[model samples]
Structures are given as C-alpha cells and as structure tokens.
Target: MKATQELHNLGQSLWLDNITRGLLTDGTLARYINELVVTGLTSNPTIFDQAIRTTAFYDDDIRKKTAAGKSTEDIFFELAIDDLTKAAELFRPDYDATGGVDGVVSLEVSPLLADDADGTIHAAEKLHAQANCPNLLIKIPGTAAGVPAIEETIFAGVPVNVTLLFSCEQYLAAAEAYLRGIERRINAGLDPHINSVASLFVSRWDHAIGDKVPAELRNRLGIAVAQRTYKAYCELYDSPRWSKLAAAGARPQRLLWASTGTKDPNAPDTLYVQALAAADTINTIPEKTLLAFADHGKVSSTLPADGGDAEKVLAAFRAAGIDDQALAAQLQLEGAESFNKSWHALMQCIVEKGQSKSTGTQAEQL
Candidate 1:
C-alpha cells in the first residue's frame, strides 16, 4: 500500500498545500484524492501568486474582469473563489463521509490585514459568504490581532484555519481563540460544532535555526516543537473544559502541521511527514513532498500523545542557545511579512496581466 494510504488509515489527514486551475481541470486533484489519499488542500498568497503568474489558465478570466472594471484585488478574489469553490466541491465526498472533519480547502484573508483585527474579521466573513462552501476554511493568521478576528469569525459561524503559528504557545493562543468562539456559541444557545484548525508551522522552525544550531540539531527543531505542541493539544482536549464543550457537541479545533515540506536539501524529504504523524491532526504538505513520500516514505510510528522526549529535545536546543519564545515571535512576524510581500506581488502580477491583454487587443485591431 502507498504510504499516503497508510497514513490516512493511521488516522492522520493528508492535505495538499497547493491549488491550481490546471490541477482541477486536468483531474489531477481528483486523482490525488483517489490514489494518494489527499483529503483536502490549502492555499495562500504565495501559492496564488505563483499560479497566476506562471499559468495562462486564468488569463481569460483576468481579461474579462479587467474589462468589467474590477479592481486588482477584486479580480484576484473572483479568480480565487472560483478555483477554491470548485476544489471544495471535488472534496465534498470526503467532507461528507468524515462529517466535516477531513476534507477542507483553505483560502487566506488579505495579509495586509494581518494587523487589523476588524478588517481581518470582515474579510473572513465576506470570503466565507462569497465562497458559500461548507468545506472552505477562511485562513486567519495567529497574530495577536488575528486571534480576536478568529474568535469573532468562528462565533459568527464561519470555519477558520488559524495560520502562521510557530511555537506551542502560539498554537495554544490560536486554540484558545477557537475555544472562546465555540464557548460563545454555546452560551448563545448556538451549535458548538463549528470546524476550525490551528495550523502550527513545522519546517520553518528548523529552517530558521539551521545555521545557528549545531549539526546534530539540524532539521530536528521543527519536529520537536510539533511534539511539544501535540502533547499540549492532547492535554487540552482531555481537560474538563474541552470535555464539557464536547458533550455539548463542540468539535476540537484540530492541530495542523503546516510547512511540513523539508527545507534542507540534506534532510530526508519525508522528515517532517514521518516525524509529525499523529491521529486526529492534519498535515498540509507540498506537492513535491507528497510525491516524495508516496514514492519512498514510511511511517514507523505515530507521534506520542504525551510528547515523548519532546522536553529532552527542547532542553538540548535551549542548551545550544536557542530561545524558543523569542524565535517563535520572530518566525510569526516574518511569516506575515512574507505573505504580505506575496500579496502585493500578486496584485502587481494581475495589473500587469490585465494591461498586457489590453495592449495585445489594441495591437490586433491596428
């Protein structure tokens, strides 16, 4: 059996960290769903930017929207929603079979709103309404501003994928935001089963400390961080607070391992995927990583819920002068900035594409 199937059977979800119109039109996404066990997908400004800039699939739509006097951002959203809605439909079977637990496709809110809580909340709501797919998750960063937005969005009955979290503490913050939202729903006599996921980035932790840490610690920090976070996740759900909510039909916001693609060339391609495997969690992996894992990956054991050796590994890093809390803050800030940069670049790409199309038409007429 393919390792992907094995992982799925082991109770971990495999979500593609990509979305492109070609994948949907060519049935590639569906093929992955059937053969590789990819239950869902996730997208961001970077992914969309790459998709729009590199492919001609969206050009006709871009030209149409440009002619309709749509703003760059508006045109981009129109294209994104169109693509994501289609992908959501393709995954609808898994979604239904799993009772809204597995199949999900995520679209992030404007990174420019990373620091604007109200704007983020509004954008999430608008996008969710516009997409109108129950399997779609509007992604919000786990930034301080975004935490409140997450709560408000969830309380308003929109599912969320809390992104950009780095450390266990950051994961906890996002989890708390989700729980608060669910608690508010219960208080208001609303259904507490709103879906959510707190995405903790994995590979970036190792990438950030790669050069700083010793050779033995290379490519190990991220998995250790996940281990620590997973323990916390299991503990939180086991608590009476979560138990009470669960009794009331509240679903635990799952712990998702994001950025699972190995960044270090010397590291094994399946390093993060193999190390972070656990039941009741999601791992959104890059296409390359997914293929690589399907080719040669092996899942020997699932991650220990009690966080085996996580403390010891973390202690070794601390002894090596890695400040966990400070670095987590830095990584989250850097991640938001990176996405903001991609968002601007994407808008610019749209503007240029629209202009080039108009120019081509004028030349043809001449």
Candidate 2:
C-alpha cells in the first residue's frame, strides 16, 4: 500500500492543502480522493490569491458578480462558497461513513476580522449558513480575539477549523473554546456533536528559527512542539470533563497538523509529515508534499502518547537560547500578518479581474 493509505489506516487523516478551480474541473481533486486517500482539504486567502491570479477559471463568475455591482469581498465569497459546496458534495460519502469526524473542507473568513471578535463571529456564522454544507468548516484564527468567536460560532452550530495556532498554549486555548461551546449547547438543549479541528502550524517554527539554531537542531523544533501539543490533546480528550461531555454527545475536537510542508531544502520533504503521524489527528499537506510522501515516505512511528522526548528536545532548544514561549507569541503574530497580506492581495486580484474586460465568454466548464 502507498504510505498515504498506510497513514490513513493508522487513523490519521491526510488532507490536501491546495485548492484551485482547475483541480476540481480537471478531475485532479477526485483522483487525489480516490487514489491518495485524501479525505479532506483546507484553503486560505493565500491559496485563493494564487488560484485567482494564475487562472481564468473564475472569470465568468467574476464578471457576473461584478456586473451585479457586488463588492470585491462579496464576489470572492460567492465564488468560494460555490467551489466549497461542490467539494463538499464530493466528500459527502466519506463524511457520512465516518459520522462527520473526517472528510471535511475548510474556508477561512477575512483576515481583516482577525482582531475583531464580533466580526469574526458574524462572518463565521454567515459563511457557514451561506455554504450550507455540513462537511464544510469555516476557519477562525486561534488568536485571543478569535477564541471567544470560535466558542460562539460553535454554539451557533457551525463547524470550525481553528487556524494560526503555533504552540501548545494556543491549541489548548482553542480546545477550551470548543469545549465551552459544546457545554453551552448541552445546557441549552442544542446538539453537542458539532465537529471542529484545532490546527497547530508546524513548519513555520523551523523556518523562523532554522538559521538561529545549530545544524542538528534544524527542522526539529516543529516536530517537538507538535509532540508536546499532541500529549495535551490526548490528555484533554481522555479527561473526566471530556468523558462527561462525550456522554452528552459532544465530539472531541481533533488536533490537526497544518503547514507540514518542509521549508529547509536539505531536510527530507516528508520530515514533518512522517514525524507527526499520530492516530486521530489530521495532517494537511501541500500537494507537492503529499505526492512526495505517497511516493517514498514511511510511517516511521506513531507519535509518542506520553510526548516521548518532547520535553528533552525543548530543553535543548532553551539551552541554545531559543525561548519557545516567546517565539510562539511572535509566530502567531506573524502568521496573522501573513494572512492579512494574502487577503488584501486576493481582494485586489478580484478587483482587477472583475473589471468589465471581457475574456471571450470565459470558456466552458470554468
């Protein structure tokens, strides 16, 4: 079996992190689902920005929405919603088979709302309803401003994929928000089975500190941080509080490994993917990384439930004068800034394309 299937057999979900209109229209996404066992996917402004900038696939819809006098953001969301709802239909079978625990696709709200809790909440709720796909998750950042929004969004019955998490603390914060949301639902007589995933970013840690650390320490920080967070995740889902919630039909929020694409040229392409293989977790990898793993990757070993050498590895970094705590804060801030940049770029791309310039009827099937 391919390593992707093997990983899935070990109970890990592999989701493609790239989505383009071509992938959907060209049958490539379907091929990945059937052949590579990719159960779900997640998209961000960056991905959409590239997709819009690089292809004419969206020109027809852009022109129609633009002609209707919709704003750039409105056009973007309509296009995004249409794409995601179609993708959701494709994954409906896996969603049903797994009982909503897998086969989910995520779309993030505007990065402009990251600092506005109320805006984030409203966007999440609105996006969820607009898409109206049970397998679709509306992403909200895990920032302090986004935590409460996450809870309220969940209480509103929208599935969430928590983005921009860089540390165990961030993951725990998001998980707490999910728990509170579920608890509130139980208290209010709402269903407690809303699905959510706490996404912990992986490679940005190494990319940020790769040159600051020793050669041997390069490409290791991300995995160690993931191991530590996984320990917390295992413990949280197994705790008495969670057991009580589970009895009330609340699902444990799954831990997701985001940004698993390797950044160091010298490091193995599958470095983060192979290292972070744990059951009941999700690994969302870029398409390049996914194919590399399916070609030559190994399961290696499942992550240690007790965190194995996570603490020891972390202590080594501290001894090297790299404070993981401070850096976690820095990375989270930077991640938000990065998303903001991409969001604006995407809006600009839409503005330029949505102008009345004709593209010859936009071809068929786009």
Candidate 3:
C-alpha cells in the first residue's frame, strides 16, 4: 500500500497545499484523490500567483473579466472561486462520507485586510456566499485583528481556516475565537456544528531558526513546536468547555499542520510528515512532499497525545537562546507580510496579462 493510504488509514488527513488550473483540468488532483489519498486542498495568494503567472490556463478567463470591467482583485476572486468551487465539488464525496471532517478546500481572504476586522468579516461572508460550497473554508489569519473577524465570521455561519499561527499560544487564541463564535451560536439557538480549522504552520519555524540553532537542533524545532501544540489541542478537547460544546453537536476545531514541506535540503523529505502524524488533525503538504511521501514515506508512530518530550526539546532550545514566544510573534508578522507581497505580485500578473492581451488584439487589427 502507498504510504499516503497508510497515513489516511492511521486517521490523519493529507491535503494538497496547492491548486492550479493544470492540475484540475488534467485530472492530477483527481488522481491524487483516488490513489494518493489527498482528500482535500488549500490555496493562498502565493499558490494562486504562481499558478496564474506560470500558465496560460487563466488567460481567457482574465480576458473575459477584464472586458467586463472587473477590478483586478475582483477578477482574481472570480478566478479563485471558480477553481475552489470545482475542487470542492471533486472532494464532495469524501466530505459527505466523513461528515465534513476531511474533505475541505480553503481560500484565504485578502491579505490586504489582514488588519481590518470589519473588512475581513465582510470579505469572508461575501466570498463564502459567492463560492457557495459548504465544504469551503475562508482562511483568516490568526492575527489580533483576524481573531475578532474569525469569531464574527463563524458566528455568522461561515466556516473558517485560521491561518498564520506559529505557536501553541496562537493556536489557543484562534481556538478561543472559534469557540466564542460557536458559543454565541449556541446562545442564539443556532447550530454549533460550523466547521473550522486552526492552521499552525510547521516548517517555517525550523527555517527561520535553522541557521541560528545548533546542528543537532536543525529541523527539529518545528516538530517540537507541533508536538507541544498537539498536546494542547488534545487537552483543549478534553476540557469541560469543549465537552459541553461537543455534547451540543459542535465539532472540535481541528488542528491543521501547514507548511509541512521540509525546507532544509539536508533533512529527509518526509521529516515533517513522519514526525507530525496524529489522528483528528490535518496536514496540508506541498505537492512535492506528497509525491515524495507516497514514493517512500514511513510513519513509524503517531505523535503522542500528551506531548512526549516536547517540553524537554523546547527547554533545550530555550537553553540555546531561542525565545519561543518572541519568535512566534516575529514569524506571524513575517508571514502576513509575505502573503501581502504575494497578493501584490498576483495583481501585477493579472494587470500585465490583461494589458498584453489587449495590445495583441490592437496589433492584429492594425
């Protein structure tokens, strides 16, 4: 059996951290679903920017939207919603079979609204309604501003993928936001089963501190951080607060591992995949990592629910002068900035393509 199938059977979800027109049109995504056990997908500005810039697949759609006088941002969403909706449909079977736990596709709100709570909430609602897919998750960063937006969006009945979280504390905050939203729903006599996931980024932790940490600590920090968070996640679900909600038919907001792709070339390609395996959680991995794992990945054991050795590992890092809390804040800030950069690049790509298409048409007429 493929390693992907084994991981799926072990109760961990493997979601593709990519979406592209080529993958969907050529059945690559479908093949992953059938053979590699990729039950879901996640998208971001970076992924969309790369997809639209590197392929001619979106040119005709861009031309149509541009002709209709759509703004670049609006055009981008129209393009994104089309792809995500289609991908959501493809995964609808898994979604139905799992009761909305596994098969999910995520689209992020504008990074431009990363600091605008009201704007984030409004955009999330608009996008959710526009996509019109039940399994869709609108990604809101776990930034301070995004926290309130998350609560409002969830209270309003839209599912969310809380992104850009780095530390266990950030995860907890996002979880709290989700809980507050659910609690408000229960108070208002609404269904408390609204779906959500708190995405904790993994590899970037190691990447950021790789050069600063000692040789033995290289590529180990990310997993240790994940282990710590997983322990917290298990504890959170076991608490009375969560139990009360669970009894009321609410699902625990799942812990999702993002940026699972190994960043260090010297480390094993499946380092994060092998280390972070746990039931009731999702790991959104890059396409390269997914195929690499399918080829030869091994899962010896799932992560400890109690966070085995996580404290010890973290202490050693602290001894080595790594300030976990401070670094987490830095990483989150850097992540938002990185996404903002990608968003701008995507807009430029669209503008350039639209202009070049118009120029070609004019030249032809001449």
TM per prediction: 0.97, 0.98, 0.97
Question: What overall lDDT goes with each candidate model?
Answer: 0.93, 0.93, 0.93
- In angstroms, what RMSD does candidate 3 have relative to the true structure? 2.7
Q: Tell me the deviation in Å of residue 220 in model 1.
A: 0.8
Please report the candidate that would top lDDT against the real structure.
Answer: 3
Cα lDDT tens digits for candidate 3, 1-366? 998998898999999999998899889999999999999999999999999998788887798888889999999999999999999999999999999987999999999999999999999999999988999999999999999999999999999999999999999999999999999999999999999999999999999987898888888888999999999999999999998999999998999999999999999999999998899999999999999999999989999999999899999999999999999999999999999999999999998877765444422433
Candidate 3 accuracy as TM-score: 0.97
- Writing each residue's lDDT as its tens digit, candidate 2 over 219-331 gives 89999999999999999988999999999988889999999999999899999999999999999999999999999999979999999999999999999999999999999
Over 4 Å off in model 1, which ranges?
358-366
- How many collisions per candidate? 0, 0, 0
- lDDT of residue 111 for candidate 2: 92
lDDT of 1 at 291: 98
The C-alpha RMSD in Å for every predicted model, in order, reads: 2.6, 1.4, 2.7
- Considering summed lDDT, which 10 consecutive residues are worst modelled in model 1? 357-366
Residues 104-219, model 1: lDDT tens digits: 89999999999999999999999999988999999999999999999999999999999999999989988999999999999999999899999999999888887898888888
Off by over 4 Å in 2: 361-366
Q: Give the TM-score of candidate 1.
A: 0.97
